[model samples]
Target: MAHHQHHNFEVDGVDDDEVPRNKCRTCLKQNTLTIATVVGVIMGAILGIILKSTKDKWSEREIMYIGYLGEVFLRMLKALILPLIISSLVSAIASLDLSLSRKIAFRAIAYYLTTTFAAVVLGIIMVVAIRPGVGHTEMATKQSEDTRNVTTVDTLLDLVRNMFPPNVMEACIFQTRTDLTSPSPNVTDVYKYNISFETVQNTNILGLVVVAAALGIAIAQLGEEARTMANFFHNLMSVSMKITSWVIFLSPVGIFFLVAAQVLQMDDIGSVMSRLGFYFGTVCLGLAVQGFIVLPLLYVALTRKNPFTFISNMGEAIATAFGTASSSATLPLTIRCLEDKNGVDRRVARFALPIGSTINMDGTALYEAVAAIFIAQVNNVPLDIGTLIAISITATAASIGAAGIPQAGVVTMVMVLETVGLPAKEVGLILAVDWLLDRFRTAINVMGDAFGAGIVYHRSLKELGLLEQSSEEEKFQVDKNNHIDETAQ
Candidate 1:
């Protein structure tokens, strides 16, 4: 029989079984940032409400001043995005075998598509059941003459064109988008318009991801020759992460001004709520179902882990997403939370999260589906079964093309309306509340990305272990051959 030995030590005259004060202090210290963020949200909301009760209305310039801190925070986060995506993706993929990388990519894309389709279906069911727009009366609003002539074919082409940027440097600041230009006044056919591909002032994230993946694959193939290059990106990723950590510390303060400024900028909240309250409620309910119920069940079923615990680990990132109202801006925090707090692997987190943020828009898909159907109902247009199916398909496709910025979903919402013969100008009706809804959907988008990373990491564990083992075996063989050659000589 073997006996086990036990040793006990007391610190500062405390007994072994007694809880130490330092432990409690350390736990609080660790969670201080999260606590501050919650406080900021509550304080900001209260301050905004109090200010709204005053007689004076806030001007645009005044609103800008109020949100100045938030502006700085957003700029800081956006500035880091380009480097973070490139460095993280390149470094992570370069370390893996080509076959393993392929497996991981396939798994991620499958998960993204599945979740997005589910969100679309859920939104459609909620809108159909709730019937929020059944009794709404159309208001008289001026329609802008500058209607964008967007078609499904043109949109799909633009997606492909942006994926393969002609100039890598230009892609950093501009992405290619097709626009329909009206013919000259003297032209006989007024309906015929020229289709011109123009550059838009937005970061071409999709193109960057594709380029980075190719570069990483080339490096992996080069083996020892690309070791120095791989090291550079690895170090670059580390430095970017460090800077992101520092910026994240400012979130509580930034979020405070952001929420306050958003509240101040609204006009006649009572009137808008009276008219659109049901629509707002419907959207919120769908988002809640997708975020709380659908995503958790998927996570639990796939990983067999406590989804709530995983979500709790990602609280900071979700809160930041709500404050910023832009998933692109929230990418840095999402990556950090997945890797540092959620125990997801660096390789999986880096490789999958950027791609997910760019493409996996579960909340956006749901919102668009609901908004489209709501518009149809408001116009008294009866949508047949075929039309409903069209809405579902279009909403899902449009969301994939939507940018991860604030109000980007509205841009894609135009396509959904046009597909189902709804007036595009009806979008104005929802603009008043879109700002608030954007924040909620963006939070859900970030959550979906985080969940995808966790699932990918879990699924890829076997391949990752095998790759590591093979590398070790290869190294041993090389050493053994060298020893034999030296002795023979």
Candidate 2:
């Protein structure tokens, strides 16, 4: 007989055994991300500096190829976006009981909105206190004349229109661009040639999610047919995740090229930093407060569990979020850790994580608030109390629709900026550091999703009389469970 010895480590009253062993594929992928992040940062910085210094010595072809490598990597990540989201959403919804679905969905969105609101408020306070954009007058002059000037009413209409695309297929397959001359133009030349002041935000991810979710819910209502569709979606999700694993393996190389290209494009990195350092610092500080302080406090308040244990278990998901700079791409891993490792209920995790990934923008909301105020400050636009409040509201709304991808906040930041009459083009000031900041924001976003999942799962168990329930409550839940079982059978 083989003998097994048990080993354990305890920290802060939580046993190490509470965390599942790290031999699983989730842990392996996370470790890969952690290593890739370190190696990629080192390689990116070194290669960026070298290429920037020797730019004149290299041929144009070589530089283009280097940039192309990074572009290809981004395309690879984008490739996973549709398939992963559709499959995951379908599988997550199909796995849940229909009645509990609404309850979980409401709780998840409520948690998401709460965290995002707090984040934006924190960001406003930090940027107001720090005043990051006070002295950078030169950056104000670098504006693109093409920035559209729309009224509040117009912006509201645009937002509504974008939320529901005319055709889900057009929304999914179409890629919106300001440059019509580029390949894969989705619209006619009228909007593409930059002749019209109107712009269409082509990546209607919210619309795609809405369509997929509707399909999933419909599939769930089909009873036995639901099982067939559920199996298909489950299989599709498995296949897509395998593809994601392959793509993630290339993260190190992708990060190096992306960062290097980012560096080479900058004429004077130091000058950009000196001007935007305060803005960047403020955003990071706000993110840290939200990720480390606010969200954990909420988690403890809800679950009465150790935040350290929760975060430790989430290490892989967080690492993957940072490396990919995407919550959507990291959704599979996040769901895995929450379900397989942390014991979050499948219903709660499946419902919360996917919805959270789509709309939960704690980090993005914080960044948008800071960026809007910073831009206003940089451009010498004084914001009154009323204007500040408006900015806050707009930031939250804009973040709801922000795509869970790298630098997605910047695109939506324009909406927030427009709310306060700031020059949308002044966003150029912070473009240099956006890539670096993106990783941090993505981490916070994923953490928020996990935290929401934890709270929802606990509440679900509580409702089932599994935790801290009276005898009457326990009996009530037992009857409810039997009823559900009979219905299922």
Top TM-score hit: 1
Q: lDDT per residue, candidate 2, 297-383, as tens digits?
A: 998998899987888788767866776678887787787778867888765676677778888888989998998898888888998
Give one digit per residue, the lDDT tens place, for model 1 in 68-181: 997898789888889998998899899888888899999999999999999999999999999999888665433733358776667777888888999999989998988877
For model 1, the local distance difference test gives 0.87
Between which residue pairs do clashes occur in model 2? none
State each model's CA lDDT, in order: 0.87, 0.76
* Candidate 2 C-alpha error for residue 104, in Å: 0.8
Clashes by residue pair, model 1: none
Off by over 4 Å in 2: 1-33, 54-61, 67-69, 138-140, 175-201, 462-489
CA shift at 281, candidate 1, in angstroms?
Answer: 1.1
